[model samples]
Target: MTFLKKHKNDILLILAVLILAGGFWLYSSFAMDKGGEAVISVDGKELCRLPLGVDTTYTIGEGEHFNSLVISGGEAWMADASCPDHICVNSGKVSLEGQSIVCLPNKTIVSIVGGEDSGLDGVAG
Candidate 1:
Protein backbone atom coordinates (compact mmCIF):
# COMPACT_ATOMS: atom_id res chain seq x y z
CA MET A 1 0.00 0.00 0.00
CA THR A 2 2.84 2.38 0.83
CA PHE A 3 4.70 1.44 -2.36
CA LEU A 4 1.61 2.11 -4.45
CA LYS A 5 1.21 5.50 -2.83
CA LYS A 6 4.88 6.34 -3.40
CA HIS A 7 4.74 5.38 -7.12
CA LYS A 8 1.29 6.73 -7.85
CA ASN A 9 2.50 9.37 -10.31
CA ASP A 10 4.77 6.95 -12.14
CA ILE A 11 1.98 4.40 -12.51
CA LEU A 12 -0.37 7.08 -13.81
CA LEU A 13 2.21 8.22 -16.38
CA ILE A 14 2.78 4.66 -17.58
CA LEU A 15 -0.93 4.06 -17.93
CA ALA A 16 -1.37 7.27 -19.91
CA VAL A 17 1.42 6.34 -22.29
CA LEU A 18 -0.01 2.85 -22.76
CA ILE A 19 -3.45 4.24 -23.47
CA LEU A 20 -2.08 6.68 -26.04
CA ALA A 21 -0.07 3.95 -27.73
CA GLY A 22 -3.07 1.64 -27.88
CA GLY A 23 -5.24 4.37 -29.36
CA PHE A 24 -2.61 5.12 -32.04
CA TRP A 25 -2.24 1.44 -32.85
CA LEU A 26 -5.99 1.01 -33.28
CA TYR A 27 -6.26 4.10 -35.45
CA SER A 28 -3.40 3.04 -37.72
CA SER A 29 -4.73 -0.49 -38.01
CA PHE A 30 -8.30 0.53 -38.87
CA ALA A 31 -7.71 3.80 -40.73
CA MET A 32 -6.00 4.44 -44.11
CA ASP A 33 -7.41 3.27 -47.42
CA LYS A 34 -6.11 -0.02 -48.76
CA GLY A 35 -4.70 0.06 -52.27
CA GLY A 36 -6.38 -1.80 -55.14
CA GLU A 37 -3.53 -1.76 -57.64
CA ALA A 38 0.24 -2.04 -57.67
CA VAL A 39 1.98 0.46 -59.93
CA ILE A 40 5.38 -0.39 -61.34
CA SER A 41 7.87 2.20 -62.57
CA VAL A 42 11.37 2.26 -63.89
CA ASP A 43 13.68 5.23 -64.22
CA GLY A 44 10.90 7.53 -62.97
CA LYS A 45 8.61 6.42 -65.79
CA GLU A 46 5.32 4.66 -65.18
CA LEU A 47 5.36 1.08 -66.42
CA CYS A 48 2.04 -0.57 -65.68
CA ARG A 49 -0.61 -0.97 -63.00
CA LEU A 50 -1.56 -4.48 -61.94
CA PRO A 51 -4.77 -5.25 -60.09
CA LEU A 52 -4.19 -6.52 -56.59
CA GLY A 53 -7.09 -8.95 -56.87
CA VAL A 54 -5.42 -10.80 -59.70
CA ASP A 55 -2.72 -13.28 -58.79
CA THR A 56 0.14 -13.11 -61.28
CA THR A 57 3.85 -12.63 -61.81
CA TYR A 58 5.17 -9.75 -63.87
CA THR A 59 8.68 -9.45 -65.20
CA ILE A 60 9.97 -5.92 -65.58
CA GLY A 61 12.83 -5.04 -67.92
CA GLU A 62 14.71 -7.60 -70.00
CA GLY A 63 18.11 -9.13 -70.66
CA GLU A 64 20.35 -9.33 -67.61
CA HIS A 65 18.47 -6.61 -65.82
CA PHE A 66 15.05 -7.81 -64.73
CA ASN A 67 12.78 -7.85 -61.72
CA SER A 68 10.02 -10.36 -61.19
CA LEU A 69 7.08 -9.02 -59.18
CA VAL A 70 4.45 -11.34 -57.79
CA ILE A 71 0.98 -10.30 -56.70
CA SER A 72 -1.11 -12.71 -54.71
CA GLY A 73 -3.81 -12.62 -52.06
CA GLY A 74 -4.13 -8.82 -52.32
CA GLU A 75 -0.44 -8.24 -51.64
CA ALA A 76 2.55 -7.47 -53.87
CA TRP A 77 6.19 -8.37 -53.51
CA MET A 78 9.33 -8.80 -55.47
CA ALA A 79 9.82 -12.47 -56.19
CA ASP A 80 13.15 -12.16 -57.98
CA ALA A 81 15.57 -9.54 -59.20
CA SER A 82 18.85 -9.27 -61.01
CA CYS A 83 20.15 -6.60 -58.65
CA PRO A 84 23.25 -7.57 -56.74
CA ASP A 85 21.93 -6.64 -53.28
CA HIS A 86 18.44 -8.06 -53.87
CA ILE A 87 17.07 -5.64 -51.27
CA CYS A 88 13.81 -5.24 -53.13
CA VAL A 89 13.21 -8.98 -53.07
CA ASN A 90 13.94 -9.18 -49.39
CA SER A 91 11.77 -6.18 -48.48
CA GLY A 92 8.74 -8.52 -48.31
CA LYS A 93 5.15 -7.85 -49.36
CA VAL A 94 3.19 -4.59 -49.22
CA SER A 95 -0.61 -4.30 -49.23
CA LEU A 96 -1.32 -0.84 -47.89
CA GLU A 97 -1.57 2.37 -49.86
CA GLY A 98 1.63 4.46 -50.29
CA GLN A 99 3.83 1.46 -49.56
CA SER A 100 6.61 0.78 -52.03
CA ILE A 101 9.50 -1.55 -52.86
CA VAL A 102 12.40 0.12 -54.61
CA CYS A 103 15.51 -1.28 -56.23
CA LEU A 104 18.06 1.47 -56.54
CA PRO A 105 20.47 -0.50 -58.66
CA ASN A 106 17.85 -1.68 -61.11
CA LYS A 107 16.06 1.66 -61.09
CA THR A 108 12.79 -0.15 -60.45
CA ILE A 109 9.99 0.84 -58.12
CA VAL A 110 6.81 -0.98 -57.26
CA SER A 111 4.30 1.10 -55.34
CA ILE A 112 0.70 0.74 -54.25
CA VAL A 113 -1.83 3.25 -55.54
CA GLY A 114 -5.53 3.79 -56.34
CA GLY A 115 -6.42 4.49 -52.74
CA GLU A 116 -7.55 7.53 -50.77
CA ASP A 117 -5.15 10.42 -51.10
CA SER A 118 -3.56 11.75 -47.94
CA GLY A 119 -3.64 15.27 -49.50
CA LEU A 120 0.06 15.93 -48.95
CA ASP A 121 2.49 16.56 -51.78
CA GLY A 122 6.07 16.18 -50.61
CA VAL A 123 7.23 17.02 -47.12
CA ALA A 124 9.66 19.91 -46.87
CA GLY A 125 12.60 19.55 -44.67
Candidate 2:
Protein backbone atom coordinates (compact mmCIF):
# COMPACT_ATOMS: atom_id res chain seq x y z
CA MET A 1 0.00 0.00 0.00
CA THR A 2 2.85 2.41 0.85
CA PHE A 3 4.66 1.46 -2.34
CA LEU A 4 1.56 2.15 -4.43
CA LYS A 5 1.23 5.57 -2.87
CA LYS A 6 4.94 6.33 -3.38
CA HIS A 7 4.87 5.33 -7.06
CA LYS A 8 1.42 6.67 -7.94
CA ASN A 9 2.72 9.24 -10.41
CA ASP A 10 4.99 6.73 -12.16
CA ILE A 11 2.18 4.22 -12.50
CA LEU A 12 -0.11 6.86 -13.97
CA LEU A 13 2.55 7.87 -16.51
CA ILE A 14 3.09 4.29 -17.56
CA LEU A 15 -0.62 3.73 -18.04
CA ALA A 16 -0.93 6.87 -20.08
CA VAL A 17 1.92 5.84 -22.34
CA LEU A 18 0.44 2.38 -22.85
CA ILE A 19 -2.96 3.81 -23.73
CA LEU A 20 -1.46 6.22 -26.26
CA ALA A 21 0.61 3.43 -27.83
CA GLY A 22 -2.42 1.22 -28.18
CA GLY A 23 -4.43 3.97 -29.81
CA PHE A 24 -1.68 4.70 -32.30
CA TRP A 25 -1.36 1.03 -33.15
CA LEU A 26 -5.09 0.76 -33.81
CA TYR A 27 -5.10 3.85 -36.02
CA SER A 28 -2.11 2.78 -38.07
CA SER A 29 -3.49 -0.71 -38.56
CA PHE A 30 -7.07 0.19 -39.49
CA ALA A 31 -6.83 3.69 -40.98
CA MET A 32 -4.81 2.90 -44.08
CA ASP A 33 -6.57 3.33 -47.42
CA LYS A 34 -6.78 0.41 -49.79
CA GLY A 35 -4.34 0.90 -52.63
CA GLY A 36 -5.68 1.40 -56.16
CA GLU A 37 -2.86 0.07 -58.29
CA ALA A 38 0.29 -1.96 -58.12
CA VAL A 39 3.10 -0.35 -60.07
CA ILE A 40 5.69 -2.74 -61.43
CA SER A 41 9.16 -1.44 -62.06
CA VAL A 42 12.43 -2.91 -63.26
CA ASP A 43 15.85 -1.33 -63.03
CA GLY A 44 14.28 2.00 -61.97
CA LYS A 45 11.99 2.01 -65.03
CA GLU A 46 8.24 1.83 -64.89
CA LEU A 47 7.00 -1.31 -66.58
CA CYS A 48 3.24 -1.46 -65.92
CA ARG A 49 0.48 -0.64 -63.48
CA LEU A 50 -2.08 -3.24 -62.57
CA PRO A 51 -5.37 -2.43 -60.92
CA LEU A 52 -5.98 -3.92 -57.53
CA GLY A 53 -9.60 -4.71 -58.39
CA VAL A 54 -8.61 -7.13 -61.10
CA ASP A 55 -7.34 -10.61 -60.40
CA THR A 56 -4.42 -11.33 -62.70
CA THR A 57 -0.90 -12.69 -62.96
CA TYR A 58 1.86 -10.80 -64.75
CA THR A 59 5.26 -12.00 -65.81
CA ILE A 60 8.04 -9.46 -65.65
CA GLY A 61 11.30 -9.59 -67.62
CA GLU A 62 12.16 -12.30 -70.12
CA GLY A 63 14.66 -15.05 -70.85
CA GLU A 64 16.55 -16.21 -67.80
CA HIS A 65 15.39 -13.32 -65.58
CA PHE A 66 11.73 -13.21 -64.61
CA ASN A 67 9.39 -12.53 -61.71
CA SER A 68 5.74 -13.44 -61.55
CA LEU A 69 3.33 -11.01 -59.81
CA VAL A 70 -0.12 -12.05 -58.81
CA ILE A 71 -2.98 -9.79 -57.82
CA SER A 72 -6.19 -11.06 -56.28
CA GLY A 73 -8.79 -10.01 -53.74
CA GLY A 74 -7.49 -6.47 -53.68
CA GLU A 75 -3.92 -7.42 -52.82
CA ALA A 76 -0.74 -8.02 -54.79
CA TRP A 77 2.04 -10.49 -54.07
CA MET A 78 5.00 -12.09 -55.71
CA ALA A 79 3.81 -15.44 -56.99
CA ASP A 80 7.17 -16.68 -58.21
CA ALA A 81 10.58 -15.55 -59.37
CA SER A 82 13.69 -16.81 -61.04
CA CYS A 83 15.82 -15.14 -58.38
CA PRO A 84 17.68 -17.70 -56.37
CA ASP A 85 16.83 -16.22 -52.96
CA HIS A 86 13.10 -15.84 -53.74
CA ILE A 87 12.78 -13.27 -50.97
CA CYS A 88 10.22 -11.32 -52.94
CA VAL A 89 8.04 -14.39 -53.32
CA ASN A 90 8.02 -14.82 -49.55
CA SER A 91 7.45 -11.13 -48.82
CA GLY A 92 3.66 -11.56 -48.88
CA LYS A 93 0.88 -9.32 -50.23
CA VAL A 94 0.68 -5.52 -50.20
CA SER A 95 -2.67 -3.69 -50.17
CA LEU A 96 -1.76 -0.30 -48.78
CA GLU A 97 -0.20 2.69 -50.44
CA GLY A 98 3.58 2.97 -50.04
CA GLN A 99 4.04 -0.73 -49.40
CA SER A 100 6.37 -2.64 -51.71
CA ILE A 101 8.10 -5.91 -52.46
CA VAL A 102 11.59 -5.71 -53.92
CA CYS A 103 13.59 -8.40 -55.67
CA LEU A 104 17.18 -7.18 -55.58
CA PRO A 105 18.52 -9.92 -57.83
CA ASN A 106 16.02 -9.20 -60.61
CA LYS A 107 16.21 -5.45 -60.14
CA THR A 108 12.45 -5.46 -59.90
CA ILE A 109 10.12 -3.59 -57.54
CA VAL A 110 6.40 -3.96 -57.01
CA SER A 111 4.80 -1.13 -55.06
CA ILE A 112 1.30 -0.08 -54.16
CA VAL A 113 0.20 3.34 -55.31
CA GLY A 114 -2.83 5.63 -55.79
CA GLY A 115 -4.70 5.46 -52.54
CA GLU A 116 -6.84 8.18 -51.01
CA ASP A 117 -5.08 10.98 -49.19
CA SER A 118 -3.81 9.75 -45.84
CA GLY A 119 -3.67 13.30 -44.46
CA LEU A 120 0.06 13.13 -43.86
CA ASP A 121 2.67 15.11 -45.70
CA GLY A 122 5.07 12.18 -45.71
CA VAL A 123 6.37 9.29 -43.71
CA ALA A 124 9.89 9.23 -42.30
CA GLY A 125 11.60 6.03 -41.26
Candidate 3:
Protein backbone atom coordinates (compact mmCIF):
# COMPACT_ATOMS: atom_id res chain seq x y z
CA MET A 1 0.00 0.00 0.00
CA THR A 2 2.80 2.41 0.78
CA PHE A 3 4.56 1.55 -2.50
CA LEU A 4 1.36 2.06 -4.50
CA LYS A 5 0.79 5.42 -2.81
CA LYS A 6 4.31 6.55 -3.71
CA HIS A 7 3.88 5.38 -7.39
CA LYS A 8 0.31 6.56 -7.79
CA ASN A 9 1.20 8.96 -10.59
CA ASP A 10 3.06 6.22 -12.50
CA ILE A 11 0.15 3.81 -12.18
CA LEU A 12 -2.25 6.46 -13.44
CA LEU A 13 -0.04 7.11 -16.42
CA ILE A 14 0.08 3.40 -17.33
CA LEU A 15 -3.68 3.10 -17.04
CA ALA A 16 -4.19 6.13 -19.27
CA VAL A 17 -1.89 4.68 -21.91
CA LEU A 18 -3.75 1.37 -21.90
CA ILE A 19 -7.10 3.04 -22.25
CA LEU A 20 -5.89 5.16 -25.18
CA ALA A 21 -4.48 2.12 -26.97
CA GLY A 22 -7.70 0.19 -26.53
CA GLY A 23 -9.79 3.07 -27.80
CA PHE A 24 -7.64 3.46 -30.90
CA TRP A 25 -7.91 -0.26 -31.63
CA LEU A 26 -11.67 -0.21 -31.30
CA TYR A 27 -12.05 2.77 -33.64
CA SER A 28 -9.85 1.17 -36.27
CA SER A 29 -11.84 -2.07 -36.18
CA PHE A 30 -15.12 -0.24 -36.56
CA ALA A 31 -13.83 1.78 -39.53
CA MET A 32 -12.61 -1.37 -41.24
CA ASP A 33 -15.91 -3.19 -40.79
CA LYS A 34 -18.23 -0.44 -42.02
CA GLY A 35 -16.86 -0.74 -45.58
CA GLY A 36 -15.81 2.48 -47.25
CA GLU A 37 -17.70 4.10 -50.11
CA ALA A 38 -17.44 2.86 -53.69
CA VAL A 39 -16.14 5.30 -56.25
CA ILE A 40 -15.62 5.04 -60.03
CA SER A 41 -13.18 7.39 -61.62
CA VAL A 42 -10.60 7.82 -64.34
CA ASP A 43 -7.13 9.26 -63.65
CA GLY A 44 -8.07 10.10 -60.06
CA LYS A 45 -11.03 12.24 -61.09
CA GLU A 46 -14.31 10.69 -59.99
CA LEU A 47 -16.85 10.01 -62.72
CA CYS A 48 -19.70 8.41 -60.83
CA ARG A 49 -20.39 6.56 -57.62
CA LEU A 50 -23.66 4.70 -57.82
CA PRO A 51 -25.33 2.98 -54.87
CA LEU A 52 -24.55 -0.61 -54.14
CA GLY A 53 -26.23 -3.06 -56.59
CA VAL A 54 -27.37 -0.39 -59.00
CA ASP A 55 -27.06 -1.37 -62.68
CA THR A 56 -25.92 1.31 -65.08
CA THR A 57 -24.11 1.26 -68.42
CA TYR A 58 -21.70 3.72 -69.95
CA THR A 59 -21.42 3.65 -73.75
CA ILE A 60 -18.42 4.54 -75.81
CA GLY A 61 -18.31 6.34 -79.13
CA GLU A 62 -18.12 4.58 -82.53
CA GLY A 63 -14.34 4.53 -82.58
CA GLU A 64 -14.26 3.50 -78.92
CA HIS A 65 -16.09 0.16 -79.21
CA PHE A 66 -13.80 -1.22 -81.92
CA ASN A 67 -12.81 -1.05 -85.55
CA SER A 68 -15.84 -3.05 -86.63
CA LEU A 69 -17.70 -3.68 -83.37
CA VAL A 70 -21.42 -3.80 -83.91
CA ILE A 71 -23.74 -3.90 -80.90
CA SER A 72 -27.19 -4.32 -82.35
CA GLY A 73 -28.94 -4.77 -78.97
CA GLY A 74 -28.11 -1.53 -77.10
CA GLU A 75 -24.35 -2.08 -77.71
CA ALA A 76 -23.81 -1.28 -74.01
CA TRP A 77 -22.63 -3.52 -71.20
CA MET A 78 -24.46 -4.26 -67.91
CA ALA A 79 -22.24 -1.95 -65.83
CA ASP A 80 -21.05 -5.13 -64.06
CA ALA A 81 -20.70 -8.85 -64.68
CA SER A 82 -20.78 -12.01 -62.58
CA CYS A 83 -19.12 -15.03 -64.21
CA PRO A 84 -16.88 -17.79 -62.91
CA ASP A 85 -14.21 -17.29 -65.57
CA HIS A 86 -15.49 -13.80 -66.40
CA ILE A 87 -15.30 -14.66 -70.11
CA CYS A 88 -18.86 -14.48 -71.37
CA VAL A 89 -20.70 -12.45 -74.01
CA ASN A 90 -22.68 -10.53 -71.38
CA SER A 91 -20.10 -10.66 -68.60
CA GLY A 92 -19.14 -7.11 -69.41
CA LYS A 93 -21.56 -5.81 -66.82
CA VAL A 94 -20.08 -4.85 -63.43
CA SER A 95 -22.77 -4.13 -60.85
CA LEU A 96 -22.28 -6.52 -57.92
CA GLU A 97 -19.63 -7.50 -55.44
CA GLY A 98 -16.81 -9.64 -56.85
CA GLN A 99 -18.30 -9.13 -60.32
CA SER A 100 -16.14 -8.37 -63.32
CA ILE A 101 -15.95 -9.13 -67.06
CA VAL A 102 -12.98 -8.73 -69.34
CA CYS A 103 -12.70 -8.77 -73.12
CA LEU A 104 -9.34 -10.31 -73.82
CA PRO A 105 -9.60 -9.81 -77.53
CA ASN A 106 -10.13 -6.06 -77.12
CA LYS A 107 -7.98 -5.66 -74.01
CA THR A 108 -10.97 -4.26 -72.20
CA ILE A 109 -11.22 -4.79 -68.45
CA VAL A 110 -14.54 -4.19 -66.68
CA SER A 111 -14.40 -4.23 -62.89
CA ILE A 112 -16.41 -3.14 -59.88
CA VAL A 113 -14.91 -0.85 -57.27
CA GLY A 114 -15.88 0.08 -53.70
CA GLY A 115 -18.28 -0.80 -50.87
CA GLU A 116 -16.89 -3.74 -48.91
CA ASP A 117 -14.41 -5.65 -51.02
CA SER A 118 -13.10 -9.10 -50.20
CA GLY A 119 -9.52 -7.97 -50.92
CA LEU A 120 -9.19 -10.83 -53.42
CA ASP A 121 -9.58 -9.12 -56.79
CA GLY A 122 -6.06 -8.66 -58.10
CA VAL A 123 -6.98 -5.96 -60.59
CA ALA A 124 -8.75 -3.80 -58.04
CA GLY A 125 -6.65 -1.14 -56.31
Candidate 4:
Protein backbone atom coordinates (compact mmCIF):
# COMPACT_ATOMS: atom_id res chain seq x y z
CA MET A 1 0.00 0.00 0.00
CA THR A 2 1.12 3.60 -0.67
CA PHE A 3 0.52 4.54 3.01
CA LEU A 4 2.78 1.71 4.24
CA LYS A 5 5.46 2.61 1.71
CA LYS A 6 5.46 6.22 2.93
CA HIS A 7 5.76 5.14 6.60
CA LYS A 8 7.92 2.07 6.19
CA ASN A 9 10.73 3.46 8.34
CA ASP A 10 8.35 4.30 11.22
CA ILE A 11 6.81 0.84 11.03
CA LEU A 12 10.22 -0.78 11.21
CA LEU A 13 11.15 1.24 14.28
CA ILE A 14 7.97 0.26 16.10
CA LEU A 15 8.49 -3.38 15.18
CA ALA A 16 12.03 -3.26 16.48
CA VAL A 17 10.88 -1.82 19.79
CA LEU A 18 8.23 -4.51 20.16
CA ILE A 19 10.74 -7.24 19.47
CA LEU A 20 13.23 -5.86 21.98
CA ALA A 21 10.61 -5.50 24.69
CA GLY A 22 9.36 -9.01 24.15
CA GLY A 23 12.88 -10.41 24.36
CA PHE A 24 13.64 -8.56 27.58
CA TRP A 25 10.44 -9.74 29.20
CA LEU A 26 11.16 -13.32 28.25
CA TYR A 27 14.70 -13.12 29.58
CA SER A 28 13.72 -11.68 32.94
CA SER A 29 10.92 -14.17 33.47
CA PHE A 30 13.11 -17.11 32.64
CA ALA A 31 15.98 -15.83 34.78
CA MET A 32 13.88 -16.06 37.94
CA ASP A 33 14.34 -19.23 40.05
CA LYS A 34 10.82 -20.60 39.94
CA GLY A 35 11.67 -23.56 42.15
CA GLY A 36 13.48 -21.49 44.77
CA GLU A 37 12.67 -21.54 48.46
CA ALA A 38 11.51 -18.81 50.83
CA VAL A 39 13.91 -18.34 53.70
CA ILE A 40 12.22 -17.11 56.87
CA SER A 41 14.20 -15.40 59.58
CA VAL A 42 13.46 -13.73 62.87
CA ASP A 43 15.78 -11.45 64.81
CA GLY A 44 18.69 -12.11 62.44
CA LYS A 45 18.46 -15.88 62.97
CA GLU A 46 17.28 -18.26 60.28
CA LEU A 47 13.90 -19.86 60.97
CA CYS A 48 12.89 -22.11 58.10
CA ARG A 49 13.03 -22.57 54.34
CA LEU A 50 9.86 -23.36 52.38
CA PRO A 51 9.74 -24.17 48.73
CA LEU A 52 7.89 -21.71 46.54
CA GLY A 53 6.36 -24.41 44.36
CA VAL A 54 4.52 -25.95 47.32
CA ASP A 55 1.51 -24.49 49.09
CA THR A 56 2.04 -24.07 52.81
CA THR A 57 1.44 -21.77 55.75
CA TYR A 58 3.86 -21.01 58.57
CA THR A 59 3.91 -18.93 61.74
CA ILE A 60 6.83 -16.81 62.81
CA GLY A 61 7.66 -14.69 65.82
CA GLU A 62 6.09 -15.24 69.21
CA GLY A 63 2.99 -14.33 71.19
CA GLU A 64 1.45 -10.97 70.17
CA HIS A 65 4.15 -10.31 67.60
CA PHE A 66 3.26 -13.27 65.42
CA ASN A 67 3.44 -13.20 61.59
CA SER A 68 1.61 -15.65 59.36
CA LEU A 69 3.37 -16.56 56.12
CA VAL A 70 1.67 -18.24 53.20
CA ILE A 71 3.32 -19.77 50.15
CA SER A 72 1.08 -20.68 47.26
CA GLY A 73 1.05 -20.71 43.49
CA GLY A 74 4.82 -20.25 43.35
CA GLU A 75 4.70 -17.06 45.44
CA ALA A 76 5.24 -16.23 49.11
CA TRP A 77 3.65 -13.44 51.18
CA MET A 78 2.68 -12.52 54.68
CA ALA A 79 -1.00 -13.28 54.94
CA ASP A 80 -1.41 -12.10 58.51
CA ALA A 81 0.60 -10.42 61.23
CA SER A 82 0.23 -8.74 64.59
CA CYS A 83 2.71 -5.96 63.86
CA PRO A 84 1.29 -2.47 64.30
CA ASP A 85 2.10 -1.17 60.79
CA HIS A 86 1.16 -4.40 58.97
CA ILE A 87 3.71 -3.47 56.33
CA CYS A 88 4.74 -7.06 55.91
CA VAL A 89 1.19 -8.10 55.15
CA ASN A 90 0.95 -5.33 52.61
CA SER A 91 4.06 -6.47 50.76
CA GLY A 92 2.99 -8.34 47.64
CA LYS A 93 3.95 -11.97 47.02
CA VAL A 94 7.46 -12.65 45.70
CA SER A 95 8.77 -15.54 43.55
CA LEU A 96 12.25 -14.47 42.52
CA GLU A 97 15.69 -14.75 44.09
CA GLY A 98 16.53 -11.84 46.47
CA GLN A 99 12.88 -10.66 46.57
CA SER A 100 11.60 -10.37 50.15
CA ILE A 101 8.85 -9.40 52.54
CA VAL A 102 10.20 -7.82 55.72
CA CYS A 103 8.54 -7.07 59.08
CA LEU A 104 10.64 -4.68 61.05
CA PRO A 105 8.36 -4.66 64.07
CA ASN A 106 8.44 -8.41 64.38
CA LYS A 107 12.04 -8.67 63.22
CA THR A 108 10.86 -11.10 60.60
CA ILE A 109 12.09 -11.40 57.04
CA VAL A 110 10.88 -13.78 54.35
CA SER A 111 13.02 -13.96 51.23
CA ILE A 112 12.81 -15.95 48.00
CA VAL A 113 16.18 -17.49 47.24
CA GLY A 114 18.30 -20.51 46.21
CA GLY A 115 17.48 -23.68 44.26
CA GLU A 116 18.36 -22.09 40.93
CA ASP A 117 19.66 -18.67 41.81
CA SER A 118 22.80 -17.51 40.06
CA GLY A 119 25.93 -18.36 42.05
CA LEU A 120 27.14 -15.68 44.43
CA ASP A 121 28.33 -15.77 47.99
CA GLY A 122 26.79 -12.32 48.00
CA VAL A 123 26.83 -9.09 46.08
CA ALA A 124 26.20 -5.39 46.65
CA GLY A 125 24.82 -3.06 44.06
What candidate 2 gets wrong by more than 4 Å, as runs, is 1-31, 115-125
Q: Can you give the TM-score per candidate against the true fold?
A: 0.68, 0.68, 0.29, 0.65
Q: Write the per-residue lDDT of candidate 4 for residues 45-100, one digit (tens) a residue.
A: 99988877668999886688899999887788899999999999999888777678
| RMSD values, in order shown | 9.2, 8.7, 15.4, 9.2
Tens digits of per-residue lDDT for model 2, 1-102: 999999999999999999999998788668766778899999999998888877899999988999999998888999999999999999999988778999
Weakest ten-residue segment in model 4 by summed lDDT? 116-125
For model 3 the local lDDT of residue 21 reads 100
Give the C-alpha lDDT of model 1.
Answer: 0.87
**Tens-digit per-residue lDDT, 1-125, candidate 1:** 99999999999999999999999878866875677789999999999989887789999999999999999888999999999999999999998877899999999999998642222212311
lDDT of 3 by residue, 18-37 (tens): 99999987775554432222
Q: What TM-score would you give candidate 4 relative to the actual structure?
A: 0.65
> At residue 122, what lDDT does model 3 achieve?
36
Query: What are the runs in model 4 whose C-alpha is more than 4 Å off?
Result: 1-32, 116-125
Against the unseen true structure, what C-alpha lDDT does each candidate score?
0.87, 0.87, 0.43, 0.83
Between candidates 3 and 4, the TM-score winner:
4
What is the lDDT for 122 in model 1? Answer: 25
| Structure candidate 1, residue pairs in collision | none
